[model samples]
Each structure stands twice: as structure tokens, then as C-alpha cells.
Target: MRDRVTEAVPELVAAAVAAPSMHNAQPWRFVHHTESGVLSLYGDPDRTLPVGDPEHRGLHLGCGAGLFNLRVAAAHRGWDAVAETFPDRRDPWRLADVMLEESGTGPSDRALADLFPAVENRHTSRAPFTDEQIPPEIFDELCAAALLEGARLAVPSGWHADDLVDLVHDAELHEAASDLMQAEIIAWTRTGRAGEGPETEGVPAYAFGPRQHDVKVPVRDFGLPRNTERRATATFEERPQLAVLGTEADTPADWLRAGQAMERILLEATRDGLATSMMSQPLEWPELRSMARDPASGLGFVHMVFRLGYGPAAAATPRRPVADVLTVV
Candidate 1:
């Protein structure tokens, strides 16, 4: 195939792995075929939360975000990467395959390359945002970004937003009362003080964001095991901004598209000087997930929930080195 999957692709993989994963598990694996020049992405079964994602939907979303980053990296490098969402019908774990090569001018390439800067800066801001309102134009732009990836961004209105908030609280209560969910949180979070040591993955105690003293913060509280003495309680903003990312279907391919769309929306928001965080608590539960979307909007499947606004950027979480996640054969 003469694909240009060369020695330098690992460096590009660095940017791909930076895409956020559930609990920073970073479950996706990339294998580059030296001779065929085929780079394949697979979801690591070892890194999963069975209780929360028995279907591995969250893992697929993370992998899709990483795949989007890979495409952007390839575009920035002047390489046209041909991607197949699922190359094998029988292999459920295989997520995607990419063949990298040079190509002539294409609008898609330029469009993806343009997002390189946002990809570099997009982050999950667990902190509170100001009560300022986002302009209508920005909302339209975000919706357009999602549409580009074949997904929909639903911005809930007055009553719907309140309904979503209540649903989120209900999901939180469900998780809090469940031992398995709490175990998963404890398994993937660090309890040590901030900057305690070098960690390649997992949500650190520092990123937990201040314990929400106010009842309205949409950010998930990761202090379930309760490290009360070390963590501080900071009042979160009232009337926090929220949105939902959805796909037309609930299949693996749909989840991948949703993930890419989620990242695109987040990057666009970042470029517009907005801080972003995710609230998948409601979406993790089937009953709660269904209630998250507005029946009036007729949105299909809600893949992710976004908290967006003007605020301080959250600290960058650690990611595995490119070598750890990529295998060369």
C-alpha cells in the first residue's frame, strides 16, 4: 500500500493520546504495521468500568476523540489519512484503521488542520465558570461544529436545563449508593496531595475541582471515598451552562462519531475562550440518559454532557507516553 506510516508517526501519536478518556484510563491502543503502513486502533479491554460502561460506549467515545486528533495531526503534517471506522465486521474490539499518504488539496484536510491549535489547547475544566451568558452566535457555531461530525449538540432551554440538573443529581445519587461505582472511582482516582508524583493516567485528586458547596454545580464530585481532610470545598457558580452531544444511533460507529463531535465542539468552545468540562453521570445510566435529552428537540442518543462557560482552565491530566499505547509490527 506504500502508506507513509513512518518512524515519525509516534510523535503524532503523542497528540492522539492526549484526547481525554474515561477516568483518564486511556484505553485505546494503536498498532502500526511497518510493511503495510496500516495503523489500527483497538480498545483495551483491561481498562474498563464494567458497572458504568458494560457496553464499552465511553471507551469508544474516547477512542474516537483520539482518532479525530490523529486525523488533525495527519492533516497538519500534510498527510491524507484514509480511515475506516471498523475494518472487520467480526472484530468487535477493532475501532478503526488508517492509511497515511500524501494527497492533493482538499477542503477537509484544511478544515481539520485549522483545528490543530484548538486541539492543542482544549482541556477539561473541572472548576466553576462565571454566570455570564454565552452569546447566541457561539451556540450556533458549536452546533455547527457537532453537525460537521454527523452529531447534534442540544442546548437545553430554561425548564429543560433544570430537568437535566435534576437528572444529573439523580444519577449521582444512584452512583453514590452503589458500591461497584464507588469502587471504580476509587480504582481510577489518586488520593495523594497535588503533584505528589509522576502519574501517567487516572484523574488526580487535584483535578477533582473544589468540593461543591453550592448545590447547582454540574461537575461530578470524585470525592466519593471521601478524602475530606485533603480536599477543599469551593462554591461553584449558580446557573452553570450545560449542553448535550448526541448521535442518530447507539451503535459503536455512532459512539465514535459522537466522540469526534464532542471534541470538535469542545475545541471550538476553547478557541472561543471558553472553559469546558463533561458530565456523563446522567448518560451512564440508561434511564437517566434517556431523560437527559429534550423530547421536544427529538434528539436521538445522548453520548456526552458538556459544562461550558468563562472560567479558569483546569490543570492538564497526565497521559501515557506514546510508546506505551502504540505497538509497531
Candidate 2:
């Protein structure tokens, strides 16, 4: 069984690496013990965003996406991948452990197949979204996807949207003013890397959305400093639809769940003809984060803020191949 599963590990890691990250850092590592037929996940400390994700929330989200892919990969290979997150209290590096299970209502192999294509196609769209609203049914479907992963998806109202936007702007400005934070952003961002470069991690130039003359909602202008001028003029939409994913209890497990749900929602949206981008700026701030959650909705805490709409799919960014991220014993 070990030798048999080892053959599947490469494809599994490839699927897992397709997950999105803060700047596409792809901050995850995987090890498979062929003798035990087990796969262990580890978070790359070097890939972590210290200032942006000091609590490792973003790191967990990235890792969680990888875990979701692992499960899908297993299903594709005719095995149910059972995941036990953070199984070892003493081993902080053990993000999750995956094993083969014979029976379960796992995701369909067709869905897993679709996921790989989606993974390759899914890019954060910083481009302008049509002013047209995403249908209520689609919104509900995204909400359901989050719930499936034990999280809540909150769609804010008029006032709520304004408030959240304000918080995003505040966070962006703060990051800009702080030398330390700016340094961290610059460190993660790279123009181009040879084979694999130090700055090979963070957000790339192509992923950066167009700079707005005045952004009401606080989306980061990753184009700042390096690219003063917008690449192509985008017809900015008046009202951009935003949603947040939350959980009732905040724990390492909750963070992991939120991460998985985040990917699910993103993938579902992609399948439904939508382009998406996310920001956790407000949530990084305690007071602002609490306000970001809708009390009326009675959902859990907000883990992420996403902008969704119909737009051109942004260019696919570079990723360190599966061979670099996975090891087979």
C-alpha cells in the first residue's frame, strides 16, 4: 500500500500546491512516509508573512487549501483521504496528517478533476468587475460552501459595506506608513526569480490590481512604488460586492477550517463564472475585525474579506512545482 500510494503523492502535492496564498507564497511543505502510507503537512516558516499574518492565520489558510487538495487527490486515486489536523500537540510543525480511508462521502472524482483545471485557471482578479450584481442564488451557494467547511459567509449591507471599506483603507495606509510592514511586503514581492529566488514568494506584479484614484473600500494598490502608472486602464465599477468568511470559535482548527472554506468558496465562485480577490487587512486589527462580522447574521468571526464579481481572469502567477514542495520516502 505504501509503495502504491507513493505514486499518488506527486499528483496529490501538485493539486495541493494550486491553493492560493497571501501573495501566492504557496507556504506549505509535505512529507510522505511510504512505509506508513501517511502524508504529513508542514508550514514553511520562511514563507510566513510575519507582519501581515503574525498569528499564522494566513499561513493556515494556505496550508488548509493544500490539505483540501490532498483529499481531492486521494479521492481521484480511488481512496478516501482522512485528515486529522494538528494531531500532535508537541509537534507544532505537523499542520495535518492524512491517511487512506476506505469509506466516506468524499468529493466526486469528477469534482476533483474539475478542481485541478480550476486550480490552474484560478487567479486573483484585481481587474475591474462589472457593476452587475452576482445573482442571489450564486451568493447563497458560496455561503453554503463555507458552511460545509464549518464557517460562515457574511454579505454586508450598505452601511456595513461602507464601514468595511473604511477599515481596509485604514489598514492599507497603516501598512504603507510603517517601514517594517512595507519592508515585509517588499520582501515577499518579487519582479522575477531565477529558478527560485528569495523574493520568489509574495504577490507578483501581474496580480496587483489597478490603482484607483480614490478607492472607497480600501483594496491595496500593490502597484504602488514600483509601478506608478496603471498597466491598462480598467473601467472601475461603482459598487463592488464583498463577502466575509467567519467562524464561531477561533482556534487553530477553526483557522484551518476557515482556510479550507476560503478555497472552496473561491473555487465554487470560479466555477460559477466569477473572479475573486481577498483582503484580511481589517481582520488583522482586533476592533475593526469584530466590526467586520455581522452580528445580525449570527455567523462566526470573520476570517477573510473577499471581492467577487464578473471580470477578466488575471494572469496565472508562478508557483514552485510539486517536486519542490513534496518528498516521497
Candidate 3:
């Protein structure tokens, strides 16, 4: 079993690295223990966002994406991945341990298998979406995808969408105006370039998606001061579709679930021929994060704000090589 398990290591790491991250910052690591067919997922503390994601929202999102990828790879290889969060009570950084099982229910694997193709194709589209509403049925499917991963996607209506747009714009302005936040944004954007620095994984310049003539969907200007004057015209559309991803709890485990659910829903949407972009601006502030939830919906904790619709697909961002992220122990 050790040799057999070792053979799956490369594929597992490849799938994990395929997970969507905030600005493509693949800030997670994989350690395979050959003695026990247990793959440990760890967060790269050095890659954490100190100012922007103080509570590790982005960190969890990045790791969750990796987890989703791991599941997909496992399913593709005809194996079942039994994951336990914080398997060790003493080690907080020990995120999870994935035990491989050969014979098991195919439900999870089936779903992940369906999403396998989207692993490489799914990306964050920063460009404006056409003023087209995603079909209600497709929306329902996406909602189901989140629910399967223990999360919920709340699609806001007319007034709700408008209000969220305002909240996002306000939060974006606040974050952008602050020097500390601005510096962090610059760091991630600049570091996004391949081989630029140690922080090699992040949203790359090419995937910044052409800048809009005027802000449309509350995109964080990655090249704010450096290329503020550059023109990458986008046809801003009115009434962008808005959906919020929420969890039942707000613990580290819940965050990890929410993050993986996010990628699952995003990939499902991408497979359904929809373009997507996520904005955590409103969730950045406590008050604003609360506002993102709908009282009528009975969901109080919101983890992510996603925009979905038909539009141009954004370019793929750069990613760190598999060799750099995977290590055997």
C-alpha cells in the first residue's frame, strides 16, 4: 500500500495546485506520509495576507481550493479521499489528513469528476459581464453545488443586488484609500509575476482583465498607482448578478469548508458556461459582512460575494510549479 500510495502523490499535488486562489497565490503545501497513506495539508504562514485577510479568509480560501482539487484528483484516479480536519488537536497548523480508500460511495467522486475539467479552465474574470441574467435553473444547480459542500449561495434580487453593489464599491474605496491595504494589494499584484520574488504566486498582470473605462463591478485595481493611466477599456454593464456564499458556522473548519465550497460552485458555474468573479470587500468589514446576509433567507454568516453572468472569460493567471509546492515526508 505504501508504494501504491506513493504513486498517487504526484497526481494529488497536481490537482491540489489547480485549485483557484485569491490572485492565484497558491499558498498551501502538501506533505505525503508514505508510512500511512495520509496526506497532510498545511498552510504556508509566510504566504498569509497580514493586512487584507487578518482572519485568514484568503488563506482558508486558498487552502480550500487546494482541498477541492485534491478531491477531484482522487475521484479521477478512482480512489476515495476521507478527509479529517485538524486530526491533531495539538497542532493548529495541521489543517487536515486525507486517508485514501479504494472502495466507497461514488457520489462525491462523481460530482468531483464532473468538475475535473473545469480545474484548469476555471479562472477569475475581472472584466465586466454582459447585462444578461444567468438562468434560474443554472442558478439552482450552483446553489446545489454549494449545499453539497456544506455551504449556501444566496442570489440577491433587484434591490439586494443594487445595495450589494453599493456596499462593495464603498468597501473597495475604503481598502484602496488606506495606505496599508494599498501596499498589500501592490505587493500581491507585483509578486504575481513569475520569478519576481519569493511571493511568486498571486494574481498575475495578464489576468488583471482589461481595466474598465469606469469601474463597473467593484474590481480591486491591481495596478492602481503603477498603471493607473493605462487604458484597458471594459464595457461596464448595469445590474451585475450578485450571490453570497455563507456557512452555518464561522470556525476554522467552517472557513475551510466555505473556501472549498466556493471553488466547487465556481467550477460548476464555469462548466455551465457562466463567467465568474468574487469580491470579498463587503466581507472585509464586520458590519458590511453582516449586511451581505439576507435576513429573510435565515443565513447570517456570509463568507464570499460572487458575481456571475455571461461575459468574456478572463485570462488564466500564473501558478507556481508543482515541484515548489509538494514535498514528501
State which candidate has the highest TM-score.
Answer: 1
TM-scores of the candidates are 0.95, 0.92, 0.94
Model 1: lowest-lDDT 10 consecutive positions: 190-199
Give residue 54's lDDT in candidate 1 (0 to 100): 89
lDDT of each: 0.85, 0.79, 0.80
Residue pairs clashing in model 2 are: 23-203, 247-300, 247-301, 248-300
**Which of candidates 2 and 3 reaches a greater lDDT?**
3
Error of 1 at 31 (Å): 0.4
Lowest summed lDDT over 10 consecutive residues: which window, candidate 3? 191-200
Task: Tell me the lDDT of candidate 1.
Answer: 0.85
Error of 3 at 210 (Å): 2.2
lDDT of 3 by residue, 77-104 (tens): 7777789987898976778899887846
Return the TM-score for candidate 2, rounded to 2 decimals.
0.92
Model 1 CA lDDT for position 40 = 93
Model 1 CA deviation exceeding 4 Å by range: 1-4, 193-198
Q: List residue ranges in candidate 2 displaced over 4 A.
A: 102-114, 192-200, 225-227
